[model samples]
Target: MGELANCPNCGELFVKGAQTVCQNCFKEEEAKFEIVYDFIKKKKNRTATMNEVSEATEVEKKLIQKWLRQKRIQPGSFPNLTYECERCDTQIYEGRLCLDCAETLQKDLQQTDQPKTLKEREDENKREKVYYNVDKENKWRS
Candidate 1:
């Protein structure tokens, strides 16, 4: 069972499932989203930037940015659509983190994996030494 919590927007008690806001706030956001979506979808507004969309639709820039980050509105179609990277706040068209942050994370993971590779090499060397000793012992016994 989900925990009962006050809506972040309205401060009213609502069974929060897919949305953090109450039903009222959720409906309001939907209306706002539709307005923004409509404005952006128009052929003339296809090249509109984030600021232009927000100004024209009277919708909050952050709200539109949320949609962009969620990929609810694809950057490919919008062309100028962008949102802050979670790590460095660099504007990016797609994904949570920017290319630099992602590359840094990849490098960090590779470094973490290096120790395991070194351990494996050490284990292999030990195995080879053991086999050599065993072969020598067997030859002596023979």
Candidate 2:
């Protein structure tokens, strides 16, 4: 079931459905998308980057990035269309991060997620332990 909410674009109260914005905003966005798509559909603009497309169409760079993330603007169709990597800001045609950043993130997550063995935990505990002994002369020895 849809819920009543304020439109993010116009701040108008509306029933939230497939889009986060209201119907009017959605229509406006659709029109903007058509403008962008039409510009990209031209043979000369097929090699245009996201920045180029945004500048040429007078669209927001962030909005163009969002469309790239959502795959509404297919990068495969345009040879030079690319978005920035979420981590390193490197240009990428697909996903949030480029291959290098993605691999590094995957490796870091894997290292963190790996469970420690009982022997490893016991070894770590042993390394952390310290014993002190007091002799007859009241000298502390470790």
Candidate 3:
């Protein structure tokens, strides 16, 4: 079923579809994509960073980041292009986090998952559980 939604870019009502924005906004974005894509597709501009691409193409950094996240602009083809890590502000070509943050997070998770002491395991086993009797009519008695 289609639902009504407001366009995030222009704040206009539109039928909700696979597109995040309305048709007008989507068309505008396609035009912008062409501009940005053409600017970075040149051999000399293959090494341009995200910031440099945004500046040279006059496109918003957020839009370029969106394109990267959508895989419309592949980082593998452009060595210097990168987006910020989700956990840290460091630039990364792929995944949500850089190597250092991912390793730190993994270490923290491993430390939290250490084996429980014998006493702790015993305490968990000793936790109370209650049982209730039910009448023949299938109703709770207690």
Q: Please, what is the TM-score per model?
A: 0.73, 0.77, 0.74
Q: Lowest lDDT 10-mer window, candidate 1?
A: 133-142
Order of models, best TM-score first: 2, 3, 1
Instruction: Show where candidate 3 strays beyond 4 Å.
Output: 107-118, 124-142
Model 1 clash pairs are none
Model 2: weakest 10-residue lDDT segment is 60-69
Q: Is candidate 2 or candidate 3 better by lDDT?
A: 3
Q: Which runs of model 1 end up more than 4 angstroms from their true locations?
A: 116-142
For lDDT, the strongest prediction is 3
Between the candidate structures 2 and 3, which one is better when assessed by TM-score? Answer: 2
Shift of residue 59 alpha carbon in model 1, Å:
0.8
Q: Which candidate is the best by TM-score?
A: 2
Estimate, for each residue in 1-142, the C-alpha lDDT of model 1 and write its tens digit: 5568898877999887777778898899899999999998999998998889989999998889878877888889999877789899998898789999999999999988775578888998887773323364466321
List the RMSD of every prediction in angstroms.
9.0, 6.3, 5.1
Over 74-94, each residue of candidate 3 has an lDDT whose tens digit, in order, gives: 999998889899998999887
Which model, 1 or 2, shows the larger lDDT? 2
